[model samples]
Target: MTTLAIALGALVLYLIAYNTYGKWLGQKVFRLNKDHIAPSIELEDGNDYVPTKKGIVFGHHFTSIAGTGPIVGPALAVMWGWLPALLWVLFGSVFIGAVHDFGALVVSMRNQGKTVGDIAGNVITPRVRVLFLLILLIALSLVLAIFGLVIAVVFRLFPQSITPCLLQIPLAIVIGFFVHRKGFNILIPSVLSLGIMYLSVVFGNLGFLADSNATLAAWPVMTWVTLLLAYSFVASVLPVWVLLQPRDYINSLQLISTLALVVVGLVVASLFGGAPIDGLRPPLEIVAPAIEQNVTAKQLPLIFPFLFVTIACGAVSGFHCLVSSGTSSKQLKCETDARFVGYGSMLTEGFLAVLVILACVAGLGLGLNKGDEFLTGTAAWNAQYSDWASSKGLAAKINAFVTGSSNFLQSIGISATFAKALMGVFVASFAATTLDSACRLQRYVVQELAGCFIDFKHRKLAEPLKTEKSFQARKTSWLTNKHVCTITACLIAWWMASLPAIPGASGIFGQPGSGGVILWPLFGATNQLLGGLAFLVILFWMRRKNMPIWFISLPTFFMLILPAWAMLYQIFVAAIGSDQSWIEQGRWLLVGIGSATIILEIWMIVEALISWKNLQKTAIQQD
Candidate 1:
């Protein structure tokens, strides 16, 4: 009953926010006029800028942003108890995440579909633009490395998921051909593709082609990582409608079905299966005994800063800004569609995060079946999340989500093996989508950076000759050659992932070896700081237009300070104070990255402030 209540309550609140606050921002704030020429029409070239229907664009946008961030963040944060995670995911999504996503999308659309990093030059300063691009490059490099390892880990741990995940690629390509090239109705084929993928899931669990003796079953984690990155290379370079859109569309259906399954299973478990509803409350209390006993005094950070950063995508994420400005902005057919594609998809992700909380809490309460061990909710959760200091904590959190969600599925009469397999497939698919999207976005960032440098060199050389067109043509040729940028981006990610794991950090997954776990500590702080910077960009844009700035201002301030505070604490108190050698090395690198990001953010904010004041004065003089 409590699970049902939270799920339904979140849905209701999101709907209200969408209709009221989201509507006002769209109509009054951004003034999204449909007549405004969108980039899809203005820049169409049968490739990235192809005009897409709102439904298709929404599917692409939602699945790309709704990746493992929502799943992993909430799954781990619930260790602090459900109440805090729940409130933040709810209010933060409505007030902060959606607003950031919507504002980034609308602003990018109005600026000829340029990325926020690119637009930073016009709004702030050109030097700030280079700095912003560097931040994106670093952040996305981490995203690619982490998501690649995440999917590989899922495949290695849950072999039953391997077949279905691999099979989706070809199926998506076929669907893309029929729907886009042959002009077939997308609905029927998309549903059919989803049905086929689920059938593969069942066969996958049956060891149909995934037998223990099969080639894939015996592959090392590195082998899997290599294959996944190779696939991402192809997926990232292909036309959007070919593989990216159709695959995400199919995955979105899988995501929705998984969410529905969890909701229904929760209702049945609470009402009919004798699960307790007392843990589902509004206030912060130590509901889980394992968290109380095992999660010691210093194991976790304070709820204020850590909670906000930890529960990133569910509440707010800087990565969402990249998706909004980088990809979705290029494909929007109508300016008005920003409200639905940008705002609506984020609310949907928030609901998914709510289900992740319920799956970890109420679903755990239903009793987890972990091989030979039959543990209650508290025991299962405690076993995994008890030690944040261990390398296994990441694997534990992921397992908790899988085991608890499987328990929910069991209440509906599904077999436990198949249930686990389904959850594994869902998670792996989400990670795969994010992995490819990050690679593609990284390609864009690299090209943008290349263009910036070329322009500077051209300015120097052409100062005497006044020959700008030659440099302009050279720049166009370089940027249009997408393969060079894409390859460079993929190789950097591969190198990062292939780096040997930190010595002495071994855990259940053994040596981390390119697994994102080594860099996971920096993810929250870096990601949230990116969000704050994105909000700062949006805030400055609105001020320049003389629109309401309060909506963007509040979130901007909160996101900036909290993440910066957390990063500083991590650098001074956590890393430098630690005695472990590997801890010092690995953590200090993250500190350096975080410190550079902070410096860049503060510099950009100051520039934006000065520009805002000067622009206001100019307006007054004109009047």
Candidate 2:
């Protein structure tokens, strides 16, 4: 009953927020004019800038942003209890996440499809443009590395998922070719392709494929990570509609189906089953006492700052800003569509996050069924989450979601093995979509940054560089090459992912080659900080246009201060204040990177303030 309440309540709030606040921002604040020509129509090239229907663009945008962040972040944050996580995911998504995403998309669309970082130059200053790009590059590098490791880990832990996950590539290609080239109806073909993918899921679980073979099983996690990164390199370089757009469309379908299944299962288990729901999977209890009690009996940091950082994508993530401006803005057919594609899609992700919380909390309450033995929900959840600091705890956190999701499926009469397999495929597919998109975004960042070094005014240098005629020109143009940028981005991410997990610092979930976890502590701070910076950028743009500034300002200030405070605590107390050596503890690298990001953010904020004052003065003078 509690699960159903939370789920329905979140949905209602989101709908209200969308209709009221989201619409207000779109109509009054941003003034999204339907008559305005978007970049998609103006710059159509049968590639990235091709005009797309709102539905297709929404699918692409949703899947790209709805990665493992929503899943993993909420899964981890449930450690502090479901209530705190729930409130943040609900309120944060409605107010902060949707607004940030919508503003970024609309601003970019109005600015000729330029990225947020690129638009900073015009709105703030040229120097801030480079600074914003630097922040984006660092953030994207971590995203590429972390998501790649996450998908690889999913494949390793759930072998049955590999077949369906790998099948998405070819299926998407076929769909792309038929719809874009042969002009087939996208709906029928997409449904058929999804049906085929699900068939692979069943067969893969039944061991009818090579994925279950001993040879593939013997390969290390790093091997899978390497292959995934290589694949992302190719996916990143392809034109949007050819592979990226269609693939994300299919993934979005899978996500919707999964969410629907979980919701239905929760309702049936909670309302219809009566005693079974209570005895087997008990109602969700606030468990306020346990919030401070972990398996290891260590107290976590105060919920204020950490909760905001932890429940990142499920609530608000800075990365969504990049997605809004980087890709979605370019593909919008109508300026008005930004409200749906940008704002509505984020609310959808928030609902998914709500379901994730229910799955981890209420679903886990169903307990673990192993053969004839059973563990209560409390015991099972505690067993995996006893110690947040242990290296192995990361694996436990991920497995908790799988186990709980499978339990939910069982309530609907699905066999446990198939249930687990289904959930595994869902998670792996989500991560794979994010990994490829990050690679593509990173390539864009690299190219944009590389352009800064080129003397575009010197045609002798720039024009010949396009032909690779002179050695100097070739050197200058290499960074601008799509393939070069993609490969370089992949390799860097691969290196970060492949590094050895720090000894003794591995949380209970840590494993060798799980280097991405080392950087996890910094992810929330950096991500939210990026959100703050993005909001700041939006605020500056609004001020310049003489629009209402309060809507963007509050979130900007809230996001900036909380995450920065949390990061400072992490640096001074958790990393340096403790007796552990910074290098041995793996805090040095994170501290340095996090500090640099904070500095860049502060610099940009200062620049925006100065610009705001000048803009005010100029307006007064004109008046």
Candidate 3:
């Protein structure tokens, strides 16, 4: 009862703190405007800077920021016990995650929506801009590919998830038609879709459609990989109205509903049911441990670098930084919106991390009373937890906590049964949405890189390629054409994503690590590294704008430095082979990527320095 009270109280306090405290800081320190016009006119005509509502923008920002990284990182952290993970969530958000997110959005907005890359070039250095873009491209591409594998792994294990997952297709198409073709309002379709989506969940639970397909009865890993990729392609190319908007609307509902369940479940279970476990220590010991009997000495004291590295997305994420500058900044209906979208949304994700870890702890406790054989199989254990939760009648409590302060899902009469079933559908749906977003984002990166290199070569070759064929073969001529470049880039991405589709394969394809491992880490580092670099730019820009350094530059500086140090430290561990852990191998691969990024960023910073100096000298001479 005490624990449940504390948990509920903590949640309410955090929400209040984030909304009130965070908002106050944003408004007072930054004086962020909720009404700034997005500088879409300043950029090229792409989907990058489209104006959007706060709710829709929140959906995009939330989905992009919350990926496989958070889930996997925190899930594995459970071995360390819930307390450490919970503390990390609580502390890390206020100091690290929220600042990075908030600062990035504000800086990007002030910079005419030029994106992190352009800001680096203009404020920091020309070389840094290009370097950051390359790193971002490689990092985001790996993210897309790795997350595809993550979705695949989950689906292969849970056959019941398929029918409900596929329900988004027709629902999205219908919503798309109303919004685009029928000129219908977003509110109506969103409301209607949520209702129907709930029904699908109920219908599936009743065995109406869920038990339909024998072929889908048990999907192999490859089938999952294929289906996930296929879904990504369709989702990415479709109108936002049809798929992205409605799907995200329901997801928003689920996110709120699940959060609500967590709170309510904690209260009811702790007070009424007396939480299944108390005084349960983390499975692993810091000393000569029973934790990793099969594990080694170097891997024992999982301290310093490992702890920070393990909590990647929740603490800080480069991907969120990209979304901040790339898409979210441009869509700000007001500058003040950054606080809500940036800090608020990140805190929300941080809260979700806490809730999920709590669920894992609670679920693990219930499993312990059952036996070891049950816990050995991760898939079965997860299923058992769901069943145990349902059996105990505490699922609704957990869902209430997950649903958030809005209780929007509960308002719609979404029952506990449907809410539990809706979780898988929502996870699969969001993953699918992110997969497509990543693909499109990757294509953009490839095209940009091609253009940059092509322009460089074009200048060099112009004198030599005076002949007809030579002129046509110039870099600009070859690479500037969007259609050709886009097709080539998409193919490259598709090929990378398809590697996991091979027969009986279990190794990473491109970035590093085993079983599609390197992708997430690389993405994590690349995203944060970009965030760091963007922070540097923001710091410089804030200084130039005469804004107080404390709120903006200080946060920017920390976001840049902490993760930069974390990545560097991990690289060192990997380089020395200090702990022969699987993560260490992944660490080494990310280190290489990180090293490449630092080199690129340093060079870019230098170029910006030279450019800045030249401009100053020229002005002085003119004076």
**Which prediction has the highest lDDT against the true structure?**
1
- The CA-based lDDT of model 1 is what? 0.79
lDDT over C-alpha atoms for residue 221 of model 2: 57
Q: Any idea what lDDT model 2 has?
A: 0.79
Tens-digit lDDT track of model 3 for 211-317: 56335644444455555655665555554445655565556665565567556654444434422225432221111111323224223234344555566676677
Candidate 3 wrong stretches, greater than 4 Å? 40-49, 180-185, 205-208, 211-214, 217-223, 237-239, 274-301, 367-420, 454-489, 497-515, 518-524, 552-558, 561-578, 581-594, 601-623
Model 1 misplaced regions, further than 4 Å = 212-217, 274-298, 390-392, 460-471, 474-480, 504-516, 575-587
- Mind giving the per-residue lDDT tens digits that candidate 2 earns over 291-381? 5445235345566777898889979999999899999988988999999999999999999898887777767767665447676556656
**In candidate 1, residue 122 scores what lDDT?**
80
Better of 2 and 3 by TM-score: 2
Cα TM-score per model:
0.92, 0.91, 0.76
Report the Cα lDDT for residue 465, model 1. Answer: 22
Query: Using lDDT as the measure, what is the rank order of every candidate, best first?
Result: 1, 2, 3
